[model samples]
Target chain A: MSGAFEIYRRWLRDRRRSTIVWSVSIAAVSVVTAAFFSSLGQSLGENAESGSTTSSMLGLSDGIDPQTPTGFLWAANYSNQLPWLMMALAIALGTAAIAGDEADGTLEYVLSKPVTRSAIAMARAAGMVTILFISAIVNLVAVAITAPLFDLYDSVTITGADGSTSTASGLTFGQLVVGGLAAFAVALGSGAIAYLLGAASGRKGWAMGGASGFAVAGYVLYTLSNVTGDLEFLTWISPWRWFIDDAMMVNGLTWDILWPFALTVVAVVAGWQLFLRRDLQN
Target chain B: MTVIEAQGLTKKWGDFAAVDDLDLAVGEGECYAFLGRNGAGKSTTARMFLDFLRPTSGSVKVLGGSGADPEVRSRIGYLPGDLNLPPTMTGIEAVHYFGSIGHEPDTAKVQALMDRLGLTADRPFHQLSTGSRRKVGLVLAFMNDPDLLILDEPTSGLDPVLQDTFRDMVIEHKQRGATVWLTSHVMSDVDRVADRVGLIDQGKLAQQLSMDELRTKSTGNITLTFPDAPDVSSFDGVEGVSNVQVADRQLSIHVDGPVTAVLARAAELGAVDIQTEKNDLEDIFLDTYSHEAGR
Candidate 1:
């Protein structure tokens, strides 16, 4: 319907300035973070021993040296800062997609028109996705063009503690894109939870806080499970399990990356249905 | 044809019912004012008519169709009691955005409504005062020339002049065959626009009466003053007059309807002056609420 299209246009236009600022900020952080790689590489190489606590925190697998170009890139930005920032952005957008507007009374006024709630749901959901995509693209392109400046594409030769030297591959452009998608997937799935909570409750604080708590629980589950391995059973609920376990930036694309995407679909459908069934909040 | 109809419509949250078992029908080309005190389920009923809040039981139909129907809603204009748009959005932007959605508003009509209301359309919603915000809302609700207008406290924040303007706009809409359903505490608005007033007290319709019926019911008291102490007995047993009392040179009698017979008696007594107390809507509104609350 043309009405639905216009609603979507207005939704995005309302958030366009924030989206642009978020994208540019992420790019700036990415470039600035990458610029310090060489300066920190040697110390991290000497101190960040394989299988250490630092590796687990950086989301690196056992024996992946933090000083390697691919390892440092994954450990420093992709696995932590970038995904966390993007996920925060996604969660905010998703929560605002319904509950935020409802609380502010804009959604109720919009619903007063000839546009169906389903149309508003679909249009706002699409707007959230567009913001995520644009932010991810900007983040990926920022790292891609500037990775060379930071020597991230140069291979690293490491002398193991056993006195044997081995060559680890440099970070590739394809891996950078894969890592970006992986981060996007995690953010999308988390955002879906935020959207679901917001849509079902129509309370901005409830949705935003509940979604944040869920993300935190997932993060703790994934990180603690990796270190202990005894809590592996609970890690299934945490999206961080797939994201950090694969560390797509280091391991290349894996089947595990699809898990967040799948979770997103399920959460979004559930949210939309609940939204359709309930009363619009005042 | 009834432009809006509700049959035993009710809304309950858990055990508390906001609106209960209400049956009402507002005909086309009429202004129906839904009046109540705060938290009396006025806004809740309005929301149900717009389908923003679903009825817990029974049915509410607008324009002979479901309120949930987009086509039905297209012909409806709505303004909430507490109007809030995005803080960053200016009134002009709000009009453009909401207009772009469904039923693209006529630009000339929009300008006319804005000009008439004296709304500062370029100011963001947050920058405007309460009355200014209400002016923007009035323009939007009237801009579409909708078949039905559901306004909740439409003149709450409006100044006296703008309140009059809003009443005029509502009258114009009614003259054009557009039905109006509004809730207001402002008696002037009720007096100017409402053809019929439905007093909803604690989610129930306590009374429904037309403006003429209300005026007829307003016959509170007629005080006859004379140069000398008037004969209270003379006014007794007069038609449509009761509670006759004499104090000094005045005879005060309560008249429920016409005072022709009572006045004739007073004329015969050569009453020098006369005073009539016409009860306004506030008394009736308070009576309805207190009556229902005491019950």
Candidate 2:
């Protein structure tokens, strides 16, 4: 096998157990969230159609109609909740890919090979990205399967705020899949950031702690920047804000996506370069 | 034809010099043993050879390529002094992983080596005993059939039978015209297999000698029991003999060279029976190190 593929294979074999666990957990969360939103949307739709006063269906301030598919509710809620779940999973898996090997002394054996050190880092990062992609797909599938149950239970047509109405049968599965995949790209970017931190630190605890703290810190800074508008420069430094703004799951792609994607590339490349240049402890 | 050449190799950690001004050459098809005490820079030298540890000064060239170059690294097999195998991997997996790194070994070659070395593929590395783990390491080192082999304390945890088997493996590699450089404090191990030995003391090469030359330099001992009280004092001044002790008709003399002259002298003194023995490698090694330290 080529060196790149060999490294990728090794990474996959090493992380097979963790990857399975992450996929299952993410899929479970997606299922549970999909179920909860479907029931909530149905109850609110019944209240709206019966001419009784109730909160707007799907938790929106706008009115609900009986014609639209329940898939819209699933997509809206998933787009809001899934990013955090995906971020946590990506960080956990990416942290282990590089730092775990260093802690276990396998780094020496791997680096002793004929392949360059940079290739090792790049291949491992690629493996983590692959894992993130798999988890995202599982999450999307869960949402797609569970969202239609809400439409059956509510007996209501889902309508957009502009008074346009569509039945559950009218929903485009392809659009939902594309939208889900775009959000997954954000998870991939987060995985790269986590991998960079892991390689730089060479300690799993430190890498995980630092990545989590960075994510939380970035979120807080982005919120503050949004509230104060004048500190807009701070949003550029926050990966979470950049990912959310770029994927535009709530609305659509924004201009801010460009900076975060660029930063993600820089972080990943820097991490790989550090791993190549530093002497392996083992 | 030098297979490994290290010139003015110096490695220092902060103010401490781990390896200092070292120059070594190992010829093709030769088994060269590096002998040193614990913390005497033997492992440091080995690491520098593989470019695992960067030298503070100087260079190491393997097969005419720089030590750090992938081309050179692929042609050399190294068994690190501290054998740290990944606990999660099986013995076979570990070998396969290294084999992938150093030009993948053919399945037939790996199978043959595992069988010869008595390594089981089913056992996880953490489950293996120390001797078994060493066998795992041995398989990795020899499986690739590289042009140069650098082994550190290669026989530390082996049983006598396995050690003998390992000696045969080294010989087999030599027969294939590969150069082997191994480091060990066990003198007899070098005596059994090494063609030439380099003795290092305190981060410096104190002496380099062939096995035959080493045997010649160290004095041998002879114990003689005279049939009668034949005044063995007459044999004391003879050349090639010293440290003569005579008590109750038993005479012991330290012989430095061939005993032909000493035996003839003993015959003249009416010796009835005499036995001669050579000094062991351990004693010779200790004496050599002590003598060098004293100098």
Best by TM-score: 1
lDDT (10s digit) by residue, model 2, range A1-282: 377677888778877887788778877866665555545654645554553222221222232232334333433343345666777877876787788777776666566557666777778877877888887787667766765664433444556557786554433455456546655665556666777887877778877887778777877666555545657776666665645443343344566545545656787888887775554554
- Clashing pairs for model 1 are none
lDDT by residue for model 1 over A43-137, one digit each (tens)? 66565554545666688676556678877777888888888999899999989999999988889988888889899988888889999999999
- Looking at model 2, give its docking quality level: acceptable
Per model, state how many residue pairs clash.
0, 7
What iRMS does model 2 reach? Answer: 2.1
How much is A99 displaced in model 2, in angstroms? 3.8
Q: What is the DockQ of candidate 1?
A: 0.80
The DockQ score of candidate 2 comes to: 0.32
